[model samples]
Target: MTKERIEKILKAGANVVLTTKGIDDMALKYFVEAGAIAVRRVRKEDMRHIAKATGATMVSTFADMEGEETYDSSFLGH
Candidate 1:
């Protein structure tokens, strides 16, 4: 993903990111610069448990966000 895309996610109020995939170096830097934490390679079952505990939704694509000019903060975990 590009810096702009990363910015979009940050702007959506997600300060912590948990993913089952690896994050690129540049993206990690962007997240750190924004004071966010990105945890990669998390187990799928763990991710589901985290979401369940925090009330966050897991998204695999940016398609839902693409049509909108702004991201929905509801996707974030508390």
Candidate 2:
């Protein structure tokens, strides 16, 4: 995933589910700085916990998810 995609998920009020091998702390930190509640490193087995913690559903996809979603600018601490 790209920085834009990470921001998109945060804007949607959803936590990001990053693959273990692909867990980028810097990216996750950026999301949190952008007002994300949390970023979770997930394995297939950890999906349940991720869902429970974030209260957001999970999706499995191979397509590149690297874009920004709309969000309220006011929520960005501006």
lDDT of each: 0.87, 0.54
The residue-by-residue lDDT of candidate 1 on 1-78, one tens digit each, is 678778888989999988899999999999999999999999999999999999999887776545744556888878
| Model 2, global lDDT | 0.54
| Model 1: lDDT to the true structure | 0.87
Instruction: Judging by lDDT against the true structure, name the best candidate.
Output: 1
* lDDT (Cα, 0-100) at 29 in candidate 2: 78
Q: Which segments of candidate 1 are over 4 A away from where they belong? A: 65-70
Q: What is the lDDT of residue 19 in candidate 1?
A: 86
- Model 2: per-residue Cα lDDT over 52-78, one tens digit each: 565544454424446534443222221
Clashing pairs in 2: none
